[model samples]
Target chain A: MTAKTHSLERMIFFSDAVIAIMLTLLAVELPVPEVPDPLHLWGALAAHGSEYIAFLISFCVIAATWTAHHMLFVHVSRTDPQLITLNLLALLGYVLIPWASKTLGKVPNGAGVIVYATAMTFLGATMLLVLRHVVRSGLLDPTAPRGVISGIQAWSAMTTIMFALSIPAGFVLGRWTM
Target chain B: MTAKTHSLERMIFFSDAVIAIMLTLLAVELPVPEVPDPLHLWGALAAHGSEYIAFLISFCVIAATWTAHHMLFVHVSRTDPQLITLNLLALLGYVLIPWASKTLGKVPNGAGVIVYATAMTFLGATMLLVLRHVVRSGLLDPTAPRGVISGIQAWSAMTTIMFALSIPAGFVLGRWTM
Candidate 1:
């Protein structure tokens, strides 16, 4: 095999491994509760219910992000060094998902929502940037339309707005629920 | 592109989309409580907290599985119809993750733990079956050693064991926390 092929192979393997590990890292933060009295379980349940809610929302959000990432990679059969770097940068934002989950879980405050939304916005933007790079670099399948990049751009913009809106919604709901 | 190439491309796209959506599905069950009172808010938090913990665990588990999947695809540049079907079966289990998360969130019972573990076990086993098919089909790089498959098998076994242990641990912890 050519040296370039070997390098590309290493890039894909390492990138996949890192993304996989980062995706799984969110699970490490779970605090296992100690049940002292089965009877008082109701009390414990009441105190912690919001956390569970937050967990589920975050889980779905993360899953959605993963799906989008996978879709973006579909057109890419080979990776250039720049593409590899772009993917890594995109994943760096992904790795912060647990932190975003924690923030959203604790307060569901405006700050928390904004923070979460901002993280997602950055992630979405990074993806768009990568898509642009790919299209410009001619790394994408030639048969795929030039408009596909615009579709990604449009989706990124819409998702960003939605994420931003969800922040205030979280806080308003958090306050209302109380 | 050759028909074989087109099929492989479609399979990769399908895999990416499915996995991404599955990851997103992890958080769908989280509560979005309407504020009624202090007690209600806290109650929501507590419930969601447990679900969050489960989501976290599943998140990591999914990432690990994705890593394994990516690794498997590394040595093989092409895939056959049967391999695609086996892969879809593996993904079918992954798609079930959202449901599993929801179940664990609602009950936190021993049975729930068992159910989650069963799903995980099936996922791991199907992965192994797919890998075996690939190896048997002679789709892998000839330069690759027999031990590569063995390596994946070892990893999957350890992962399965971890999930099995965590199920009971999660149940006990959930009970205690509640």
Candidate 2:
């Protein structure tokens, strides 16, 4: 294999592993609430249910994100150092979900809401940044029959929408929790 | 482009889009409970909380599923007709989730739980079946570092475990909901 191919292979392996682990880490943030009695257990489950809703939202969103990432990489026959590093930066934001979840779970407070929103914003923004880098690098086949640019733009817009909604939603949820 | 590459590209695009759409659909299943009294909104939210918990668990599991699929596909350099068909079958189970959620939401009883569990079991099993076909196709570089057999074996075992847990848990949840 050429040096470029070798490097790309290593990066793909690393990226794949990191994304998988980070996705798994989401579940660890959800601590099973304490309640002995079945009745009380039901009540506790009901009480903290927003945490679950938020978790589901984040989980599904992350799945969509990963799906999009997978689609992008499928066309990527090779990657340069810059593309790999940028992709890692995007994955870093993904890996930070546990911390973000912790803060979001404590929501109804302004700081926590802002922190969570900012984290999501960074995650979405960095993903777009990485995609732009990959596209600009010409790593995509020039003869790729279809326009990947539009797909990238569409995905970026969707990410932006999610981030935008989360800001106000976070604030509202934070107030409610508090 | 070679016919194999074109066909692979189409399969990847369709599968990825379906996965993304299905993951998004999971969140849309959460309905804002009807409440005539604005003052009773909190109570309504509290009442429907278990639905949220169910959504979260399903969401996380699906995200984990997507991650697993992503990792497995990394070793596959090309796709065959049978493998693509198998993947579509696996994804069919994924797309069925919103309907399962709807059923589980309405009945919240033994039958609904069983149905949900069965759906999950089929989903996991189908994924494993697809993985096996991909590995056996020799499209993957045989000398590739990742051991195809072991990886599939581990994933297969995990799928079985998940299926096993889903059935029992479904029974318990079904009884509870009933």
Candidate 3:
């Protein structure tokens, strides 16, 4: 038996499946307040403010991460085992955002918030690794714009730092920040 | 604004994201018992055996649904408003599976299992609608194998029947079946 090369389409299909699942799962975790009546609907939701906030924050985080991932692949045309493996790891944490969001909602302290941030931290750090692999392994599509490589690197660096900083921020903000 | 045409890539990507999110969210709802010591791990987990069972059933359901979706799109090169809309409706039910599974896990009766089965029934029915839409709208790739198209239709029809039957079976079996 031989290891088969995967097309860019399949890889993207797999990744997209994972992300769609994660994004929609976030909505399920959104605190569905027991309204009992129309008058109490908005009030009940407002009561679970923390849950709403956590949901919104994680939603934005996932959306932004997707943009970055999508943009990176816009320039990527092929894949290897290592790159796919690295991507799977990132997707692991990406899918975990909701559970982490739950921890934040329930605990909303250094203990719980750190767990969420740590997961994001892992995602960010691993994303940077993927970017580095792409560049170091010469994965970029040749004849691409000269500025594209530097653009990706700079974006990855910035997001990596932001995610790294989020870890410490979780400790300081105590679930107030994602 | 004009209605925009969607590429197959974007459609697949969107579908993938939703599936991934739903699949992973099922895991989060699995009853996680507090095991302060390593020795009690198995026992604690065993206490939530039913949840695990539900998780397993739902996971398989989601995986099968994804396979069908991926396969269908393989023969589809382009899409229109109706197809996308039908797929969206199907996805709505797809994303609801985990939540219904949670209910089934907790209640484990006609009430809960029926709700779960109802969602699947919706998915199964809507999937057939998508299939029919594809056939009627002339959306299939011209070169697609004749056997493949018929096979998909037969599969969809059968699954839809099974899902429809499951709704009543939910009452008869009273949570014994998924």
Candidate 4:
């Protein structure tokens, strides 16, 4: 690979590493269920159901974000400093996911939902910004199909809109907003 | 990329992702120092110094492991089922580092040191097994230099031996084993 190609590959690898870290960090916050007796094990786990739910929700969000990123970068053949900056902005939001997820697990209230939803919204929006930057800056491969670009754009936009909507929905649905 | 190249690339990507996750998980276990007064902040942080030390030690171990993995795979032109299995075994040990780090941080006793040291030993040994498998199975590119191969072997072997030795040293040094 040429130096330019190597640079682009490194950026993708770095982004993947960051996303993977955020995804696994979701599980780090899960409390290990302890019980005086084996019989109460199930009860203890059930009591922490909200934590599990929070983990699952955040896991899905990160997974979707990674999938969109993977798809977008597959078509991207190069990177500019601005693309790198935008990617870092997206990662900043991703790095906060575990903290937000933990808070949601502990609180499971309107405030908790809002915090989690806002983090998700920020993550999604920044990722969309990355997608827009890639397209407008002509960073994609020459042969990259227009249909694929459209598909990725649609996916990113829909997720951003859903997360944005979830901010207000957090009040009405409370924990169910997850 | 051909299907075979894609498969190998995916395997490398997956390994990198797992390592990244394990590396970042070390930070998640660090407790946020809480102080009622700003003047007490440094004191509270000092009280949790062991946790920071554990995090730093584990971070270096994971970073070294990743560098070795990256070096080895750069010359690996192909992958087999056995290589994939061995890689997973290496990852199994990595996945435990955060939990071990957390235990070491909280306990900081002989037993804690032993646990953390053992985990590091397991991770290093498994990674060495991966390196040997890749070499013995002739997975490397034909153009790969013999010196690079030997250098990686030396690095992996040395790390494994050091970690193994630390298990016994843990009894004498306790927290210093980190």
Per model, kept true contacts as a fraction are: 0.00, 0.00, 0.19, 0.14
- Residue A50 displacement in candidate 2 (angstroms): 2.3
The residue-by-residue lDDT of candidate 2 on A1-178, one tens digit each, is: 7887668657765665565445444543444444333234446456767666656666667666665665566566678778877887887788887678767766646666677777878888888887777778788756653565568658866876677677887678757877
i-RMS, each model, one decimal = 8.6, 10.6, 7.0, 7.6
Candidate 1 residue B1 C-alpha distance from true site, Å: 4.2
Q: What lDDT is obtained when candidate 3 is compared to the true structure?
A: 0.72
The residue-by-residue lDDT of candidate 3 on B1-178, one tens digit each, is 1223246557667777677767787766654354333344356557777777777777667665665665566677568889889989988988888888898778766777688778888888888899899888888778767786778789878877887887887788864554
Which ranges in model 4 have alpha carbons more than 4 Å from their true place?
A: A174-178, B1-11, B20-178
What does the lDDT come to for candidate 1?
Answer: 0.66
**Ordered list by DockQ, greatest first:** 3, 4, 2, 1
In model 4, how large is the Cα lDDT of residue B99? 68
TM-scores of the models, in the given order? 0.53, 0.54, 0.54, 0.57
Candidate 3 lDDT by residue in tens digits, A10-116: 66768777787778877886766888899888899888888788889888878877887887888876776577667766766676677677766666445455556
Clashing pairs in 2: A108-A174, A108-A175
Tens digits of per-residue lDDT for model 4 on B1-178?
Answer: 6434654786678667877767766786688998879999999999999999989988887887788778778899987667766765675577667866886676545556666778788988888888888888888898988998899889888988887887777666643443
**What TM-score does model 1 achieve against the real structure?**
0.53
TM-score of 3: 0.54
DockQ of 3: 0.11
Best by lDDT: 4
- Model 2: residue B22 alpha-carbon error in angstroms: 24
